[model samples]
Structure formats: C-alpha cells, structure tokens
Target: MLSAGPTPKVPLDSWEFVITTETGAEYRWSWSELMALPQETPRVDIHCVTRWSKLGTTWQGVSLDTLLDGIDTDAAYVLAHSYGGYTTNLPLDDLRGGRAWVAHTFEGGDLPAEHGGPARLLVPHLYFWKSAKWVRGLRLLSADQPGFWETAGYHDYGDPWREQRYQGD
Candidate 1:
C-alpha cells in the first residue's frame, strides 16, 4: 500500500544521485548527467499497489518529453530497465504525459537506496510497480511487453485510477 500524506515539498538542491552496484561499488551521478536530458520537477500524487497513497509529492527527473527530444522513438513501447533485471513495459503515450518522471530526489532528500536511490522511475498516475525502483535505463520496443511481476499474474497495465492490481481486475 502507498502512504497517505499531505505530501510536503522539500528542497532537493543537495540531493546527489548515487549508484551502488551489487558488488558494493558506488558511483555519483554528475549534475551534467542529471541535467543532460531535459528534466521536469512535478508535484504529483503517488498510488502504490500496496494501497498506500502519498499526495502532493515533489519529484525531479528527466521527463519523457525531454529525453525523446532529439531522438526518434523506433519502438511503440518502452522497457523500464532496472536493477536485478526488473522491468516493466508501457505504451509510448503512457510515458508522454508530464506526469511521468525519472525521479532522483524525494521529500527534499536524496532518495534512499532502499527506496530506489540513484534513480527511480516515478509513474505517479499508475500503481507503483509501473514506477520501477532502482531504474537504470529505458529500452524502446516495437510492441508491449511484460516484466517479472506481470509474468507472475500481476496486471499488465497498472493504472491506479482504475484500481488495477491483480489479474482480471
């Protein structure tokens, strides 16, 4: 479940992105890289399949609009590649809205590693799974694909508004 919150906005100026490998190697992302692509800071509400919802969340990250700025998206969908081969696919449109973000900072602090630090995909409009934690990269695809949980019976499109959770929801 997601956490319920009045959702406070905290200054994220000092939050530096940190990447830790399974072998314990740590790398810090430079501001140039963080801002290499166009980024958007949005005040959004998050809904987790776990059922906790946190409102008024302030997040900062590269927006799909910014990332696809000069490149042609050859695929009809995208694969959210994360640590441990965790991934989720979504139609191009789903990633377009200003609603989606690759958030690097949360609640005025660098996101904790336990909470997908370094970077995480924040799909505020969908169930949290759609927002892959510990995100690394995004792969464009020609067709829709399912990820680990999806193959295990979770809904393919985790839309929070529709309350899509388990199969046949």
Candidate 2:
C-alpha cells in the first residue's frame, strides 16, 4: 500500500463531490447521485511517481468531460482538492476528452477506502500522484498553479513516459 499521507476517513453517506470554477459556479454530486450518472469502465495503466507501475487496471466512474458538460470555461488549469486537504493540478486539456474519470469502483467492485473509495480522480496519462485520492472538488483557474506535491518539489506535470517525477528532473 503506497500512500503520500494518512488515509482520510470519508463518510460515504454524507459526502458530496463537487466541481467548481472561479466564477461562482459549483456542481454538487451526491455519492449515490454521481454513481447513477453515466459511467465508463476504462482499462488504465497507472504509473506512480515512486517508480512503480500497475498495468491494465480497470476502473468504473463518470468521465471528467461528461461531468463538465454544458459548463463553459476559459480556464487553462484546475486544482483538484480532496477531502483531506490533498490537491493536484492538471491542465484543462488533461481533464477533458476522456483523459480522466471521477472513479468510484475498481475491478468490478466498490472502490475500497484505502484506494480512495467514494471518488478519486483517475488521470492515467500522468503519474498516479496526479490522480488525486479522495477527491472532493475541482477548482478551475486561469493560471497554472502548482498543487501540493508540485509545491513540494514534485514535477508539476508528471508524465510517466518522460519520468517527470521531481522538479528539475
């Protein structure tokens, strides 16, 4: 089990995942409600920034693009905030076009909390760290602001193929 911080105990019954933008826009998705939304099962190979890779894993959830449907935004980046103060940044392009998901299930079962149960961002193209665990919200920004790990010297845009693990790598 790899963890960058303590696992947050998210209350499944009372939690609501949210997506927001700078211009006073917000969408609240109750756990059950979001799960009822259109879901996709994508086979993703996750590469961790810590030098490990899990290949061809399956996940089921709502695609980021689908969640953003009908929402107009000119922002170029997003700060994905989680229930436990964890945050990661992704370019607007990264979260669109089926590149990411707000996943709630893994391997044909409800996602275990240890693996970010209720909802987590799944961005397969980038290092797993960019797939923020226990994700609760996404705040759009016009500027590319660094997230938690990025601010702590990890690469802002973690591309696994390029092995962009740390700042200045």
Question: Which residue runs of candidate 2 sit more than 4 Å off their true CA positions?
Answer: none
Model 1, position 145, has a per-residue lDDT of: 78
Clashes of each: 7, 0
- Cα TM-score per model: 0.77, 0.96
| Deviation in Å, model 2, residue 153 alpha carbon | 0.5
lDDT of 2: 0.89
Cα lDDT tens digits for candidate 2, 1-169: 5667888888879888887886868988898888788989999899987788899999999999888998888888999999889889989899999999999989999888889877889999999989988999999899989999899998988999999999897
- Could you tell me the lDDT of residue 104 within candidate 1? 80
For residues 53-126, write the lDDT of model 1, one tens digit per residue: 88998877878666555454456776776655677776667878576777888887877666776678888888
- How close to the true structure is residue 11 of candidate 1, measured as C-alpha lDDT? 30
lDDT of 1: 0.69
